[model samples]
Target: MSVCKERAWKTLEELSFIRVAGTQEELKAAQYLKNECEKAGINAEIEEFEIDMPVISKATFEVLEPYKKEYHVIGIGKSGTTDENGIETELVYIENAVDVHLNHVKGKICLLHGRLNPELSEKLIKAGAVGTISIAGSFYDEKSIADELRPRNTFGKGGQLPGLVMHISDAEELVRSHPAKVRMVLLQDAEKKGISHNVVATIEGSDLKDEILTLSAHYDSVPYSKGAWDNATGSITVLEMMHYFAKHQPRRTVKAVWCGSEEIGLVGSRKYCETHKDEMDKTIFNINFDMTGVTLGHEICCVSASNDVMHAIEYLAKLENNALECKLDTYSSDSTSFAGAGVPACTFARLAPMGGAQIHNHYDTMEHLDPDSFMITLNFALHFAKQLVNTTTNLIPRKFDEVITKKLEERKKWFSEEKDEKKKESEENKDEKTKEEEKK
Candidate 1:
């Protein structure tokens, strides 16, 4: 009746593949998890949700004028594409976007030091830049192992400029040689809403069936990664717990969700919260596992709840001689969606030491993960979830403090802004149509 780490490791190996959000690979992974649940005597359902999936058909970057050479590049996902031919413009490197560099970037294709975040995107828009190129990966990365940067939702905002990513080595060469002009030809298959799934399997409680305790992990990985440690580890850990809870019936309902599209901005979890609003009241707490199984990683718990819950976790970890650093702050994971909906939540992750494991790239493979390390984390998580889910009386409060509440409010602001922006865009289109009709 006890949880077995070897069984979990086998499951992890089965799901260890590059399953990007909204892709067929992602769906394949979802189906695999559902099949596993069915085999374990639990009925699972694949709940579909819509997400933006950009397919980059062509992305080419070349430095002209100063040096004529082509380097490898990838189109930023969801970042708009260029015209039929392409764009050739003066190239500048704006290290930090200072006022002097901002003025220099006007009508030029600029190379930024890192990924373009929202604030930088806004500044680029203000600076009237034509396009952008971001540098990624270590300088030591060979062309064979260079990480390709895909467009993210963060790059799809109003002020975002079309962008491509290049290796840090190429960037260094370009900066050293001072390329005056560059040509960028980026094309993408038209973007549309694509479907991703949330694989949900439930073990209904014999006593408190109404009260729910959900266990979650994002099974989807980023591009070019097998994601053994970044997520398949977490997904399989929850499956192991589900296997245990299925044999040992809990006092409260326990649901295990293998979320898709979490790497692309928590899309699956947000959809779950939105569709299951009526069940939110019944959801007592959410325990999310993400990024584990690294040989040189530390177990960390981030509780997006009151200080009392934080203390409870700390005390329990100490009582069990578990090595974890628990803190009271929001962790960026699928758990954010549950906490935003006023359901107390916490996320447990085994943070790999710097240079020990590489996530979001091809380096994140099974070779980087240690099964023994994963077992240690799995044992601690199982102990914690079991005690909370089978509590004789509900001593844990579900209310969140100002700190957690404020984080949720800030996280939810993007939804409001996006709605407002869409409304305004629709109205503007209507006005344009009316003007064209009058002219006709």
Candidate 2:
């Protein structure tokens, strides 16, 4: 595959911007990238959808009454209107709101950490919380916040919740502000019902038009983080790959997808899969690239689609360069969204993890990035994509091994279960201590 440094860098520069949730910034970036694709003679379109309530970008937290220390809400916060005077509520650390009680939080402000447990995020709203906060964890903090974190969509179903997020440090400071009375205001002025967009480019196959190979990277991201290494790099990687595939048509219908809203809970990729059900059924292979910035300790492991797509990627990796690091992503990237739907899919990204904060922070500016290893990943991905595009042989449709996927899910479930058990035990011990003190 031909590597176009200029074009790749060009696309990167175009998208190296702050496309916060549902803002015109994202639209502008997606449109510009679409133009770049069109210039390359590849048809590209924006898959547009409205946000439930478009997130309010700039939100401020000030401790009024006594002290006034500003706290930056970690990510795209709840979209709502609050009193200009700010809402007063007792700040309490509700360990895991999802796993614990929500009703006790009524008429109070709640700060939740310990991962964005689904049960927790929704509980705050049910418990009548004025606002909700999620402290950053060791999870994919960067990418997850920018693109993956989202309130579970309850469309055509049930009630919704209001919430936002904060980084761990910010959350800790607020939590430590015991007896800290403050006014928390969330500015949620604008919102679109449900708008989302998907960016796709197609290259006509020379011989086989029916068979397809999709090299996908979600183009959309979350707030509080710039999704450069998380996915801007992945999107640019696809753009550069298009340059090669367009110049040399592959045997299979090769498509490059820059899916939108992947961060806010796989909305973009999930919707794309649903809309293109027919095309997806015919999809022989889907190779997803996310966080391929080549870190020192991380191996580029392949979470292969059960049907041997890993073998293809492996073969291609060896064929291209054996220096590539192989990795295993059980609960990472947009590929899981596809895999969960029973589609044959896998994820590829940088081996190193700053808990995914490289392009996540203000520091993600391209000026501070390391492209040495990034180039290696780009080259390897391009080669793998090219190999799939050129293959005339049909990939063996082996049922994606549910074992690995299942095991990962089970582990997550077990961890949560164990954590709850431990927390309960700790609570019991605290109760015993109170009784002893009373007796004394």
Candidate 3:
């Protein structure tokens, strides 16, 4: 009935593999979770969903004007493609690609300084840039680490430009060389669709079953990462909570969702919210875990709900003598999706100190994680969760303050824009099909 650190660690080891979203490995991890739940006398199901999984067959970046040299690169998935000969144009290094930088990006292949976001992508496209080269990693990174450039995907809005990512070291050299003309080729199947899953397990309460308390964590890892610290620990944390609730039935229903594709823009959790929209009214609260169990880390809680909920969590931490830094802010995790759906949500994480551990790379191994450290957050969370479920009245308010409401509104706007773009594209495609049928 108690939280078992040994059992959690064993499960983490079992899931220590690169389980990227929309991949076979990801499906394998989902199945494993389902099997584990079933073995524990819990009813679990894998809910499959379609995801945009572009396949990049070929991508090359070459400098031709100053000197003829080719650098290794990975194509940005879902970024539009170019011809076989590629896009040959002047290469401009736009330091953040502000308004002034974007003014002259027309007919050029811009070398962006940082990661590309939806706003930046729209700006570059509107500026008539032929292609883009994004820089990744730090200049001082070791050669081995620098060589492994992380692969990313375009936001998939309309008119996405073909993009490539290269190592920061190579990017520095290319800038120093003052390359005038560059050729970039990116060939990818942008329309490709792949399947991802969310492993859902429910332990219905004996009473007050109408109200639900959802616990979630992402199981999908990034490429080259086993994700032991990034999320395997979190995945196990929720599973352990499920085990505890199974032994000690609560007064409110508890649903544990092992979300997939969270690395790719919280897709799994968003899909869950959209699919189960009718249940939002009864979904009282959501508790999400992103990264935990680090050997050298501190516990932090991000509440996307009202200040009252945040204060309650702070008070609980104080009462339990659990050192935690709780704040009222939106976390970049699955909890955001639940909060967006009007459910009070919070994300719990044990963040490692800088230079202590890192994620989203192969270095995100089990070395920096400990079973004892992992239990700290989970144990405290269980205590806090018990009060919420056992209480007669829902003490937590479902409303957000002005600041958090504004943030949620902004996030909703972005989601709306993406949805509008997709709808427009679908209509255009349908029109094209209709025209083709008329011609036949």
Which candidate tops lDDT?
Answer: 3
**Between candidates 1 and 2, the TM-score winner:** 1
Best by TM-score: 3
The TM-score obtained by model 1 is: 0.92
Better of 1 and 2 by lDDT: 1
- Candidate 2, 133: how far from true, in Å? 2.8
lDDT of each: 0.86, 0.64, 0.90
Write the residue-wise lDDT of candidate 2 on 15-95 in tens digits.
877665456777777887789888878888777765555445445566664567766553343334465566776666787
Ranking by TM-score: 3, 1, 2
Backbone clashes, each candidate: 3, 29, 0
Q: What lDDT is reached at residue 421 by model 1?
A: 69
How do all models score by TM-score?
0.92, 0.73, 0.96
Which consecutive 10 residues in model 3 have the weakest lDDT in total?
Answer: 151-160
